[model samples]
Target: MTSTVRRAGAFAILSTLSLVVPLFDPVTAVPVAAAVLLAAFAVTDGPLFDLFAYPDDYEDGRLYGLITFVLAATALGLVSVMSSMSTAVFVGTVVLVGYGNLAAAVTREWTDNPASHAAAFCVGATTAGVAGHAISRTLTGDPVTDTFPKIVFLAVAGALLAALLRDILILYDDPVVMLAVGFLCWLLAELVPGLGATEIAVATVVTVAVGYLSYALGAASVAGMLTGILLGLLTIVLGGYSWFAVLMSFFAIGSLSTKFRYDEKVDRGVAQENDGARGSSNVLGNAAVALVAVLGYAASAADLPLLGEANPELFLFAFAGSLATAMSDTLSSEVGGVFDTPRLITTLEPVEPGTDGGVTWQGEVAGLLGASVVAGLTYAVFPDVGLVGAAIVVTAGFVGMTVDSLLGATIEGTAVGNQGVNFLATLSGAITGALLVLAVAVL
Candidate 1:
């Protein structure tokens, strides 16, 4: 058999193991099975490795895909056993991972078209969702109608995420897709019970429209559009459209800033690459922290342990702060690069406009303006967030901008990339926003 056929067959056969999960104690059986698989794969010359591994696996001297799959399965098993997640959901995730990959592999062998691979994976995801729903209904005796919508939503989300990750990531795509799908299932079960068909439909329509509009505006590339859609859906579903608007505000301000003095920036060789069409990295670096804060706020609403104990409002503030920081940093770098002769932030020495860690008064003022815009939006969106909260967000944004400059001056190029500094700066802004909220409460 061809290597592709062998891989597909192996995935199909191994995925069936999920069917027997209900018969065994997942807590014990999962660990023992995982241990055995690890041992088997550890043997380089083993039949299991030879049969299941890919060409890249030989180059890496290990079965990376299989190892990731095993790890993902083990994680799902542990979550199922510990949480209120049903065994059927775990089975569904495993099937989705395996069958989805199998379908992709087979489709790839036939044709190299990306759209075809995505369609095939979606089919596999839908099949897994149906299987999971049937098993849940059969085992739990729940009304079929009760879980159908959520399961269907999960399937659709899994398909989108799988397609995006498969297209973007060079490795570990399957495991990440599995974990994301599993998390979505868990969220549906535990946190967002109100997310029925209507909410899903609305979220999809709004996100897709916004994503397309952004792409048309040349603010985002194809990958950026997909990432934005996913993140936009999560923000709307977890928080609300108002929160999503906050994110859009950042995107609008950043995009406009990049376009400001576009010709001059290009002449100086400081313009954003691809005329400021954001890719996946740019989207994730700027917005991931804000997304995490939205998730945290959702968890707080659901009263999930440590995250729950904190005031949910704190997360909202953090969300604003993160976005504010992103806008500030973008404006400072993009707008400042065109207008001012910059000085190094660490030392008072003149530097090129595009130089890392460069600072100019024009940039600082623009950064503050960017922060103020987001903070004003925050105050407008949430009535409870008074002037004090808005001021805190602005302060946090400025602090994050300073942090970014400091990091750029010190360790950015040597130890961490630009994205890492952006992430850290946003994280700092988030923490600052949250802490200031707490301080106000304490005082």
Candidate 2:
């Protein structure tokens, strides 16, 4: 085979050998791990710095050789002065960077191809998993049961999802941004209480299963599936299974409605691409408001004193309102388009089907029905809120739907895409719900 392939194989073998050393002789594993990692760096001819250069740009290996030599010498020099923890951190950094270099070198050829990028992603994921587990082992002596390991698992899993999806989703245009989003989502999930080995395992399994199911059903693209996994896990873990049921109902209603007049929508040139399968932006736009509410609710439950006494009522209202708005807007557009011609919300004049800001009596009525479903379910969760709270949810949802139409007709495509419109509408619904509850409490 080629020289690079041979070098990669050698490096992989060294890494594997280093990992197995712990099984044979635990005491010497540390020094041996350090040696193997540094040797892998040398064997690969310094893959790390090479990543900084263009893939086509060739460099003399001797320069990298000198740099590696200098770096190794410096690391050795610091060993005398560094504390145990400092030395461990330094070594860990070196190992991670070495693995990263290998991944970058191997995937350089397939940088532009989504499917081919998996090789590089696998390398990165393995590195992250190993480092995270090692840290957990150091701290708790049990990687499987510890806190940090679960966080690492979630982070790496989300990263893998993002890497597989970034090319297909406009929301994740930048790799850094996509990775940051995954990190943040995991961070929030970590803050939830009672997330130990069992919860983490359950969340992982459910995320994977839901992701696969959504993809298989053609309800979502790969990006949307990734987004769904993150959102669904948070909803289930923090909001309870009943709330998750309500969440799924919204997705079910939206997806089925989109398919009601799929062929006609395509003919009209107003149909969503990929047979109305949603993307990352669509998923985030619809669910992000509810996610915020989930985070707030969890924070309240965690009893963070700074939050000034957890307002559970406001949290419930926000969550219900967001779902209600999303369902209402979706049904209004999809189902309304199926029946009657629409009139511009801002004007008395009739407009063609699928026109922005267009609405019909049939569509508005259908939207109310959609909103009612969410309100009813939400009330079922909080029966103490009574029928008035449900009424408030439906009204706020309808108001948000109205705002969506108004924005769409006025300045949707110019200043914001459909996703942006949806997000704002959901936010509006949430705010309205929170305000109404506060008003009732004050009076």
Candidate 3:
């Protein structure tokens, strides 16, 4: 009983400190608070996350958790600094970070009760929404523009809530249900007499219609289609229609490639899961990093002496590179499966066609061809990317493909899942593309 009391008291104190310290000293408080919360979770197992307790590996878990906390803190600090000059961006960054925590909490599948998740998400979202609004107003001294933070919070929280309710109520993935939830949320937001309700309603309608059409076209699974819609909405809100169009082009290329040898692939037993239909995991793995780049670009257009200016060019480079990697990987696997034989990428020894690390000349050529197509698309879409930028995109794609093969040969099947491998490859491609842009600007 004493132990429980002590733990509870500690948590209360830490929670208070977390809230208070951030107000006075944000830089120090962010990481310290994260560590304290992680420690609290490890000690008491968290009220809603007891099943996640690691009694057997407490020390190891604590160490890893602390490391993650530190990394998160560092990232938050960077964002804070980058967005310091803009009140809207500053508020958005803080709220986005808080939203991440809410997401993590609510989506903890180990929790027994759906009600608990919903309650926690609602409370967290409300607090974050109110706090972001207040902060933006305080910083800008302009109530008019400050409303943006609240709207952003509303969209994000609504989307998350919709996802949670879909799982609990519908109990299955359905595009129609998800889109309905999204549309309803937007309608409610607009009905309250705020920013041009007609415009918001029209945009929402068009976006949802496009998403449904994509689903009917068989470009994505139900879950994938919904994910794409949500992601697209957010990106369009942050960037512009052109940016969203560039993003959709990637999907078009990737989906078309999956259909290239569809029947043969199924017969060879090497087809993508679900008849080449992508899911939410695939969408996120390929495009999440690009979305982050978009956010960064939205936050500031500052010039990093090393990375050049944060501009539309940089964002498109990241977008194209990641999509290029996804295209390369998909084309390689689907088209390469049609080859007579493949050799292990690492050993050069002949292996089964479907082996994780297997490669073929035909597949390699197809992968490059796919990457080049993305480069052309990127160059055409974003006028900022010239012929040199196209080359850079192709190079990044090739590099990512190599990384994918190396990881697959060494650890993909043994330790990491296929999704993880895909994410890593796309991440590498984004990094490589960004670096090339920086190099060119510097030179």
Candidate 4:
């Protein structure tokens, strides 16, 4: 038979074996399950993905790649379910949609080239929109999410405005970042370190409003978005945030910072041909991690035993620390970028603005100020411990920033690179924040 026929035959088999995978993979599949599954399906059945197939010369190799993807996805999906029943189902739905498209794209004879990847992404994007609609419904459930709808609407809408207002607004990255960080905030909850979804959503909306108003109003150079997010979160802690403060803070800072030091552009490094799709994947990672973080937050917010009840102060400290870290990171990156002479953090000598471990007077000050902003907001939320918490967060955040810089400079794109280091950066930041809060409270 022709190679085309053979390739088509393999693809068809992959679609059929979709269910059979779970049996062998009841615990875990082979190294590259997704690609393996696809390849297996194709080789055994014929007609890949039921949508497209390999070039006559590259059929075998394509099958290998496709199977690896399937196996990985299955493993990922299962793990997601272990975390949250709802999340698992949600991810599963996405897989189902993707598979259906895989089928169509296959029968339609789509290849696993850039075009196919894009087609897959389109399917995923559509799935996200649908998921949002579902979330809208969930938010408005019989009992509703209570404060959620207002929070989501306010946060998402607010951020959009901020992006639009900026002289050089980056709507995609900021929102995507918030969306990503919000999710990361969720995952951090697994550490029993937490930030609430309500607060995050509110922070998001408020940040947007603040950023946009700052920009549209032509006020601050950097817009001080982190200032707005913390402020918004603080308002929520006080039961609800007022828009007036958000707008005022962003505007005041935006307008006041006339000298303008840092360039607030998303780094060129972040730019890639497949950035949109990669960004989308990162968002997925965010979703998983964020949900966990949200769980930790909800536990605390609701005064639950394991997370919140253990030590309210500790939980509070965690939240403060995370916020401070985020703020410091943002401010440092933003302000530092604009500095005329950034320097090495360790040496205190001049270096490039975007260089990891590099620091500048402008950036350091920005970092300090950023931590202070979050700390101030923390005070506004729970006045009794606000100052202490903020101080802890500030110290921790700056340290985290320094560590992140070190990690980036030393290993991020280099030979010593490791994912473990990234986690360590986060842990050190949280620990720094937590320790500081505890130390002061002891006094």
Top candidate on lDDT is 1
Misplaced by over 4 Å in model 1 are 1-17, 23-53, 57-75, 82-84, 102-127, 130-134, 171-173, 176-188, 212-218
Off by over 4 Å in 2: 1-127, 130-153, 164-186
True-vs-predicted CA distance for residue 138, candidate 1, Å: 3.4
RMSD (Cα, Å) of model 3: 10.3
**Candidate 1, residue 245: lDDT:** 90
lDDT of 4 by residue, 358-438 (tens): 777776788678767756766675667655565676787677667866776666666434233434454566667667766
Total clashes in model 1, counting residue pairs 3 or more apart in sequence or in different chains: 0
Error of 1 at 110 (Å): 8.1
Question: Candidate 1's residue-wise lDDT over 27-90, tens digit each?
Answer: 5566656775776467675677777777788886787777777777778887888888877777
How do these models rank on lDDT, best leading?
1, 2, 3, 4
Candidate 2 Cα deviation (angstroms), residue 110: 13
Candidate 4 displacement at residue 284 in angstroms = 11
Stretches of model 3 off by over 4 angstroms after superposition: 1-157, 164-203, 302-312
What TM-score, over all chains together, does every model reach?
0.83, 0.72, 0.60, 0.48
| TM-score winner, 1 or 4 | 1
Per residue, candidate 2 scores C-alpha lDDT tens digits across 311-404 of 9779888888888999999999987786557899999589988889999998899899999999998788766868989998998899889998
Give the per-residue Cα lDDT of candidate 3 at 125.
Answer: 43
Better of 2 and 3 by TM-score: 2
Alpha-carbon lDDT of model 1? 0.80
> What's the CA error at residue 389 for candidate 2, in Å?
2.0
